[model samples]
Target: MEEAARAGRTLLGKRLLVTGGSRGIGRGIVLAAARAGADVVTCYRTPGEAVASLEQELARTPGKHQVVRADAADPAEVNRLVAECEASLDGLDAVVNNAGSFLPRPYAELEPEEWDATLRGNLTAAHLVTRRTLPLLGAGSSIVNIGSTVAFLGMAGGVHYTAVKSALVGMTRSLARELGPQGIRVNTVSPGRIATEALDEQPAEAAERERRMFSSFTALGRLGTVDDIARTVLFLVSDHAAYITGQNIHVDGCV
Candidate 1:
């Protein structure tokens, strides 16, 4: 199935901008978009080891990829990132709002600054990125917002993250209704617990419990991988999903 997807150049000529795309699920989406023949621009706040590895990996791929330095919480930087992507790719075919931060502080322990930071990174960034880049997107283009299953299913100690993540659903539905007439599709991909950098901070016992819980919820009896979310995202933005929009597709392995 993976090879078949790679063989299908359905996304050829598409130009995409993905935020927080230096690593984890965002990196997965970047590679998937490129594998589907789309020109991809990924935004990152810092250049880490993952960034170096991704650049090396992309260098070997046939697809074109550009890494832009930008802070998702900064409106100015977001606008500049869009302009850079447009200049590099000629136009915007899709915007994948995948850049987000996860800090699971308890409600009482959560500071005002934490709340603001969470909302700014997760919700506001998506809105700002889309708003600035929409001008470059036209008919037949799409926007894929990366949401979390925690949006619908509450997770304790992750109040701020869950609150902002839930916002993506409403945002995508509204954007879909408004952009549909213009032939642009907006959708959300809500993923379950995936083993990514975000999860690396989890306490061993807590992480084990989470694993057990997510596995039980999923009939597949396994945790989801970054590639799973990436493949789903690729389909959503491709011609295969031309008729789909304003929907939230959960890529949580049956959870």
Candidate 2:
């Protein structure tokens, strides 16, 4: 009970809404926020063991936590998600836009539909979610949009992905300027290659090739982990970052 009580005060009662919180980096953020004493209402697109497992883990935490199913790209679903966050968490003090799609294809072979899907999934989804959730957030609220290092360095087969991520950086700056008057802060967290389930799914040969390539490029001499991004996110939303806003923070290990 003492430890639970301590955990509940970590974020000083901040309520957070995290998109795509059931898996990968999203899962890491949800869990970390809960541990930091924030009541979290997170959304997932599907039901699976991952969602079930996160539900169980959050149950042990002190703050209120809910995992719901909502397609971040759909406006109707995003509205429902915002409503659920308001209903379940009372109000929102922070938002983490971590839901995005990464579809890699040669620029020459990319279809119009694929390009639209990638934009809707990565860029438009953030706009929709943020616009809808803005009403619930007030002064001192923070928003962190998850971007990729590819946005800066560019990836050969991921032109669409990189383009949308680059847009997020611009969006972050614009939103920060517009919302700063209200004491709201917005920023982007761009991560390099991180070891997530997606990374594990790569063919062994491809994975090894990437490992060898990234090792020489990164100053830290290895890839990042989900926690590497999560910790940065946690700080960005906390009071410690009160004076900071409209910044693009790269979590990539100096590549």
Candidate 3:
């Protein structure tokens, strides 16, 4: 399936901007987008080993791509990101608001500042990028907001995170209505506890425990891979999902 996606060129000739592409699921999507034949411009918040590794991996991909150091949560940086996108690829065929941070905390312990920061990074960033980049999108273009399944099912210790994540659903629906008349589509691709870099950072025993715990939550009895979510986004932005819009497509394994 992976090889087929590479050969298929699902996003052939498409120009895309994916935010928060330095690590985790965002990193996976960036790699998948380039491999699927899109001219990609992705951003990272800080410089580190992950950023360096992403650049190296993209170097071997088959499309024109750029990795910029920018914070999507900042309006000024988002403006700069859009400018770079326009300059690099002319205009965008798709925008994936994948840049955000997640720091789970108990509702009692969550500070007001943390809530505000979370909103800025996760919710406001998507709005800023989408609004600023609207001109670069046109008929047949798509905008996908990376969301979370916890928004629907709810989380015990993450009310703040859940609130912001849930906002994507309403945002996507409204934007789809607003942009549909212009022939643009908007949707949310919510992931369900997909294993990512955080897992790798855990001690082996703890990581195994987490993997097993998360897997037990799924109907499929397995955790989802980054590819599972990436492939879904690929379809959503491609001609295959041309008729679909304003919906939340969960990439979880029925968790």
All models: lDDT?
0.89, 0.92, 0.92
Q: Across residues 1-255, which tens digit of lDDT does each residue of candidate 2 receive?
A: 988778555586899999999999999999999988899999988899889999999999877999889999999999999999989877799999999887789999999999999999999999999999988999999999999989999899999999999999999999999999999999999999888887778999998888778867899999899999999999999998999999999988999
Quality of model 1 by C-alpha lDDT: 0.89
What is candidate 2's local distance difference test score? Answer: 0.92
- The residue ranges of model 1 lying beyond 4 angstroms of the native Cα positions read 1-6, 197-213
Off by over 4 Å in 3: 1-7
Each candidate structure's count of clashing pairs: 0, 0, 0
Ten-residue stretch with the least lDDT total in model 2: 3-12
Model 3 clash number: 0
Residue 81 in candidate 3, Cα distance off native in Å: 0.7
- Model 3: how far is 202 from its true place, Å? 0.0
Q: Could you tell me the TM-score of candidate 2?
A: 0.94
Rank list by lDDT: 2, 3, 1
TM-score of each model, paired residue for residue: 0.92, 0.94, 0.96
- Top model by TM-score, which number? 3
Q: Write the per-residue lDDT of candidate 3 for residues 48-166, one digit (tens) a residue.
A: 99999999999998888999988888889888989999888999999999988778899989999999999999999999999999999999999999999999999998898899999
